[model samples]
Target chain A: MSLFHPTGPRVGSLLSGSIRQAAMTVARRDHGTPSESDGAPASTVVEARTSGPSAAPSLGPSFRSSEVIRVEHLAVSYRRSDGAEVRAVEDVSFSVREGEFVTLIGPSGCGKTSLLRVMGGLLRPAAGQVYVNDVLVKGPMPDAIAYVFQDFALFPWRTARANVEIALQLKRVPRGERRRRALDALDMVGLAEVADRFPRELSGGMQQRLAVARALVSNCGILLLDEPFGALDEQTRLVLGVQLSQLLESAGRTIVFVTHSLQEAVFLSDRILVLSHQPCRIKKTVEVPLPRPRGPDQVKSPAGQRIEAELFQLLYRESLV
Target chain B: MRIRPASLAEAYVEVGPVRRAPWWSPAGGRARLRGALRGRRLRVFLLRWATVLALIGVYEAITRLFFAGSLFLPPASEIFTRGMGVFVEEGVPEALQTTAVEYGIAFAVATLIGLSCGAALGAIPGARGVGRDLLQVLMALPQIAIYPIIILFFGIGPGAKIVFGVTHGVFPIMLSTMSGVGEVEETLPRAIRAMGGGWVAVTWRAVLPSALPSVLTGLRVGAKTCLLGVLLAELLSSVNGTGALVMMYSANGRIPQLYALTLGICVGAFAVNTLMTVVERRLTRWRG
Candidate 1:
């Protein structure tokens, strides 16, 4: 990679210090190649290439560039209640490939949630730009993206199916079709039987599932999840981690997951972007070359464990910052 | 004899190593407890009425024995001696008729104005802070002390009485609405906005339903106060309403009919309060 020669120098890139130098230091990750990081001890990329063609859903001309989302040196800051300026996200740059399940992992209060909010156009970045589906995102585009919140955020007045229906309702889908699609999404999440149940009536795990179903009910190509399983127990988390991976896989959707759990990131993600503390920055990106149908054993394998440990070390050091 | 078997859920219980508390007793035991409760319910009902009857009896006996001839305190028997007679002979109905009509109009209009103003203040943060200070100040001020001026401006008629009633009744509704709108969760608005909802949708779908229970409570408070305010204004001027006749009867020391008329107005006010309370409870049934 050339040290200086490049396309028009983006002002946001200067704030991150460098673009060309940073690109060269990182491996070839612009495309969904996710090149497998060979067994080089302490190599920054603790990952392997994704199973390319199997993950590809469309053969259309639009599939030429696999990048579905690009965060161009984003910086987000806001004023605190004490009237002090707090920088939430600082010069965080990364790209998510189409049909990829990428996880943003960091310690608590590290701005992973802020970054996720920025991606969904819920919060504006102070500097830089976020491009989703090749268009600059200025505000919430329900048709382009769907968000699943940690608290479930399900409408208590609405039934499980009606909650899901709202995703389509917002898109202006006809009532009949919205209902049909809602039921189908519920079935995909194994919640079809409880379609009429109110969100308050459901258990913690079920409520989260209903939220997931709501996200799916929308035809949005990208799903943004912020700690969707953070409130669940160990047993439910493990089960959901596997089930969610399969659900997203079959649906051929791109998902950006925000989480604090290193193990969860390793288990579900095609690539894991470890974020640093407070004013969050991308610390490392790990690729899991582990084969499909990842069982508990696969997640607990030596390779997975090594990548998880590396992420933990980066997180621990960044937590102090 | 047993009426039925324990439910399927109840049948699965394993015996505890130690005897459990009666509070943790089986569903079968609950049925027996419920049956016993039914018997006690009737007795409780009788006992409640008995308590009221005993109080009235005691009051009548005490007044009859001590100071029976005093013009101030009247015996219960004497109070009801002209119970039906007061309605026809003393013009009690006309007084109550005027008060009821004025109270109804004042309460209804006050509620409409109060809810709208309160909702506006609550939905907007800047308005809420200012409204909170101003509303509390107005509600705290003794409106009774200012009734004379209200009558001087509007005159001693139903018009003045209604204006007083409305002024008194409007605050609770406004206060309740402010708090109710505040209680609506922030998440609902974001969700609606994300789904392409406009301001109208957010106000109607999220703000209104969320604030409903408290608004109903405010309305109930408004209704009770409206009646009191109208009566108070009437009492100040012996021109119209039950307030006017009550003043007239008391000045003449007609204690029995005065007591009876007072009792009727009190009962009517209580009935209105009960009705509003029932409506509020029904509207808030969705609350867990």
Candidate 2:
């Protein structure tokens, strides 16, 4: 089973092996022509195998055509106070296709964030490598990847518009273009009215929206969201999730979203990757059979309920261990 | 699933926008009257003025009644009447000019040194530990004890006085600036880096602005200390300046004129402090 070819028939064969060796074989085989496996007909095979009895429908030919990001046998660990190494994420390998929304879900402290950080080049992996557009990610590629942190790490001093403009300013975009694009991004998040207000002056939901605006203003092809709506209340989370779905659907950008909410995972993702408890590894991969541009209606649908129920069972089982 | 209120109107009656109460209404008139007299700034201002006027009245009453003929305690009225004599006195205006020049130069130099040294200590991890300890020790030392050393190095001219003022003023500014820079959150720098901001941009956009409020506070405290240092140095060794004039008036037993000169200096210090406070508040408006 090759991890790089996500929709291949060989997915169920490999488990708990040395991924480094497997990665080399897979990388060498699929490195040059990554999208060869994602042909139009292969998506139905994906739906039948992963979605099972509640299979909805695929996005058809034009969607998820090529590979934009590849992670090969990635592992993340950090040193403890006594100098012992504690592995957080182990043997995690996945690929995000162009314009696909993939969610990583697991119990708390499962190192889902570490995997995302490794992909963003904010945290270095102990093993394996991440590639964006076939270029190895050694450090933050601000031009190619924009990250929305869980904590809404906005500059307290700058106004909302200025905060969004910072992304373009870093790339040395001219002043006029920067202003136009920053306002446009703010408008997309329904925050154009409060564009001149400071982050602290905004409510929690608005602040997260401001963070999304900042990420969007960069015009990057890929976005890495780390529990962006984690701190909000239930209603706000649903609203934001719906807004995010609409926004991403239009933009056709690749996204790797990390979250803890089962309903959120089922509602917003094209595919959900469930991870095991500690020393995180892929526990199960569920293809969302729900339709795109998701809203509250999707979560109430029968397919959404089945996916959510499966995810809850997987997480509940892991918690007992 | 539980049923929600089909309409909020089912739980409570929905009302249209209420009309405003007329000014003649009893409750409205009473509320307006209370509002006119109830405000934080107004209360504070009235209290402050009352305290000053009461103290002046007490001084006037005590000196005129209890110390009627004493040379040491002149009446408040006599001092006010003789205050104009301070400017008219020979060499008095020249002495004031000298003090102003020394204070101005010392303040400018201290600000320059304090900002640069503070920024260096704040920005560099290597310097922070040792530099902070050294600053702490210097700040705690009684600056007057070092006056003789300053005189020995710079001589008993305006140079010595200015140097003394700098020593007294520099510590507060430096310490505040250092702490301001140090207290900037680690997330801010990381956020800037993630945006592709280099070292200069991070310092300019994140570090400096975050530290500004603390730096302004230090400046306010430094202004008062510098003024004190200049006056103390003048009183200790100089032959001319406002400090020397105080010495001469007291020596000649001109008590009312001496009181008048002291009052003038106090007024000037008060004005400078008030001005600094306003500036600090103006710049850190975002804190609100």
Choose the strongest candidate by DockQ: 2
Candidate RMSDs in order: 13.0, 11.6
Candidate 2 contains a number of clashing pairs equal to 0
- The sequence of per-residue lDDT tens digits that candidate 1 reaches over residues A230-293 is 9988766765675576455544577899998888888887788888777888888777766543
What's the number of clashes in each of the models? 2, 0
TM-score of 2: 0.80
**Fraction of the true interface contacts (Cα pairs closer than 8 Å across chains) found in each model:** 0.18, 0.26
Task: Score chain A of each prediction against the true chain A by TM-score and list the results.
Answer: 0.80, 0.80
Across residues A16-114, which tens digit of lDDT does each residue of candidate 2 receive? 122243334334433432322322332332223233313434443453346678888999999988999999999988777766788999999999998
Off by over 4 Å in 2: A1-65, A79-85, B1-43, B126-130
In model 1, how large is the Cα lDDT of residue A73?
92
lDDT of each residue in B1-288, candidate 1, tens digit only: 010111222122111123324544686578656755788876887899999899999999999999678888888888777554687774667778888888899998899889988988898888888888999999999899999899889999888999999999999989999989977998777777766667787787777878898899888888888887898898997487889998988888777788888898989998999998888776665453
